[model samples]
Target: MIGREDWAATALAEIREMTTENFAAELESLEKRKRKKDIERRIIEGPKQPWRPTRHGPMREVILTVNKDWFSEDAAFFGDDQATRENEFGAHAVAWLKANFGDDVIHARADRDEAAYHIHAVIMPRATVEIAKPKAKVPTATATRRMLQPSIHPLIENYEAAQDSVGEWFGGLGLVRGERTAAAIREAREIGQTPPKRRYHAKTWKWRRQEELRLKADARALKDERLALDARVVKVQEREDEVETVFAVAEGVSSGAFVADGASGQPGLIEAPVAKETPPSSPTLDALRKRSPVGFARASGVFGRAWQRMFGQARVSAEAEAAAGVADAMQQVAEADELIAKASALLPQQTRTIIAKIRQTIPAIMRRLEQRVKPVLDDQKQDGKGPEKPRRE
Candidate 1:
């Protein structure tokens, strides 16, 4: 009974009301147009429906945007020359839009609600499509009447030409066309591949809200993963430092660099960090080292090999690090424009620019803050800091 009577009565009623209200404006517009058409025809009433919009309509929308830096909240983009740049860009942008779009641009607005100046426009691409009137029953001397249907204009046929034309018009404004996009398109065309299609972020709450939620979720996940990784890294670092200390003491005792406490009538136990819980740390190693001096040396060697196998090849190579730093510096140098574009005017641009310029030239940015990063392999190598053990593999 409930299913037949009111399964979703509330929802259905709300949907019906919402849909009717949404189309109410369209109905009003159509009625006004119908009255005008009636006056033109000199008739009492117009057809029930004069025009109906099709799925594949002749109407199109275009959005033009200025660089966000131009309209900074705090300070000017070009300092005192900010107004000059804005005026120049605005004049050119308006001229370009009007000239290209003309009277066919039915609905157009310059929106400055955001920091950047942007134009929103709708283009009606109108053309004529002729249809010959059916033959009259009675023959006449005059030719048959013809009716013409509307069609889209040829101006918007080539999208690439429009893109190039806009960039060319704005060439003087320091705002370059999407260089990466153009390069990618050219590369694809040269290789006989289809050029990448341009994409626009949809300005709807439904999609944007979902995207925001997804990004937040991803951030949380990444943060959790980082914390877990940090914990593991801390454990590994502490253990490595302790193991290095043990190796140093063993080497000094064996090489007569320093005498062991046992030789001086002290305790026989070798110094090592004994954890509170029962944990394995080269379990067989301590036992073998207690036997003889030769046994101790062999046991340490065996333990070192075991550690290498367990840890995999995570050795710090200075040459590799240097190469990476050089590559980063070269990349920074090449993207000098990108650095300028990304910097906000709210902050001190001159200071940031100077810093970037300095960094771009340097082969590597020294990470001095991170004192934790040590050259584990280098210290073991010909540094004379520790014993030189023969690598097993």
Candidate 2:
């Protein structure tokens, strides 16, 4: 999340020439324009085409609209806030489209300036047998009349009615109402009827444009901020690596220097000394003594081998534990990715909220990993020791 100061600074830096009043005006204008453009793009692009069966019939277009009334007081449902009502609404819409329309709904935004803060989505209405035949026979005509038809499903009817209701609610809040659908408004205009006054005035357009620039500047600043944060994270990771090295060294020191009986037995600090001078010979005694030295060497060798086996096992265990931890982290990353993808598929208002939530959680996760890795690294560093040298035969 960006602080207010940072956002203000970036805004001031990007559009220093414009007065605060003018800037605000321009910002609002840009947002409205942007929204309009986005809607147009979705409509033109159409819904993603799905693979159809050879025996299956042609598809039909279904256009759906929602009235502005279903939204919150501040038009917060339409605004670019994280966790806003609009996002939840969009999610619901998409879910409904996919489930009821068999995933063939093409989403389109109508270019109707008469209805500001409105949405126009297109769906392929071939899911049920009832709507399928009409849709298939005259797909375009069916789609065009779907909004005006009285026999339409109650769910869709309610959604359309909610727009005017929402506008009335907004009017109560001292905000202008945006009630008419683009299609309805256009028909009135074509017939020489005086349409309702636009909620957005010239000043509003100016403010919207300014806000767009501010948002763009803020986004650029955010990109730099993210890069810096990533660098810091990398540095912290390097420090953790150093700490792990320390931990390994400390562990080695704690385990002692050498093996005595075998690789698995107690560690030996130093090797036993070899006799330099030969004693006067008693054949039997000499033989036994000779055997003693050989037995001692063999026992020590066995102990060394056992120690190695135990050390190897410890290393493998450590590696496996580390791998498991990495896997867990990866799983979380995948979940975060999924959330991001879902957010992206939504409208701008909803997208921001999901992204914000994801952003909020990242730092905490990073801190937790750093804390866990630090101690092990510290131990490794403190235990620093070199390998032992081989003795002469």
Candidate 3:
């Protein structure tokens, strides 16, 4: 498909330039003879009605081009053996022309043209036919008119027949007519009709190339979608894992495996402890007020035992004063257990719409890691020590 700009570049690619008989001169000569006879007939008949329209004049131009990728990019004609394709395609086209137009096709010369290996020809059809012109007797007649009838090129005469002719020529080379033409022919076959072609096609390599590029872009878009889906799936799994770890720690605290330390002035993660046996699940305000220090130590967990070891006499009283209110401490643990349970049940989901807010943040995470490590690397360099070699992930 040469554009207007490309036409200049492709001028040399026009292979197998063919020139047929001078259609204008020949058609005029036939028209003149036909006119003389028409005039005589008109005089005798007194000018008949419903005459042929002016547009129904004899053919002067019937331009046709046979352009197919098979002749340009296929193995036999072009791709692997370009010379062979150009030669054979031109030869076939010439042979077809001769068959259809006879030796009037005297100037078919194969040229290595076309990134466009197609051939084109213009025809002017004029068939000599026999028409009766009354004479006194045939023996007495001197010479009769070689009547040239108003005939048409096969293309204009019967487009379908012309389609079959051109299609069959390349059929031997494993090429069919255009897709539309082929589909129409298939329908015609089913209906048991031939010729009077109802379909025609004008497709070019440019159209095909655009289709190819469009498919490639669609493929890339699908690939990107798949990658995004995989990333989301991985992030979901990570969220689930984090939720599971939190659930385990909270369950331990809720079941009394770990409890708030009575000895610590501040009850925190490090001061939390597990019960040695079946101690009170959590320290309650009533239990702390009613139970003695010894009973409280037994009810407490590892923290009670650690307090006993660290402060022999003082720990007995420290337990009651450590937490501001035993009920408040138990309430906090209960709230934590509830929070962990909610987080576990939600998994990748959460109270904060974690699932809805999922985003690809690997680059941000990596940048934060680098920010943390820069100071360490700087310290090492300041101490006259080379930074540690970075680990390859």
How does model 1 fare in lDDT? 0.46
TM-score of each: 0.32, 0.20, 0.30
Ranking by lDDT: 1, 3, 2
lDDT of 1 by residue, 330-358 (tens): 34323432332343222355744644543
Score candidate 3 by TM-score against the native. 0.30
Could you give me the TM-score of model 1 versus the true structure?
0.32
Please list the C-alpha lDDT of all candidates, in the order they appear.
Answer: 0.46, 0.41, 0.44
Higher-lDDT candidate of 1 and 3:
1
Best by lDDT: 1
Residue pairs in candidate 1 whose N, alpha carbon or C atoms collide under 3 angstroms: none
Better of 2 and 3 by lDDT: 3
- Model 2 Cα lDDT, one tens digit per residue, 254-352: 233221233334532122233222223312222322434433333233333333333333333354444455455445434544444443443355644
Report lDDT (Cα) of residue 245, candidate 2: 28
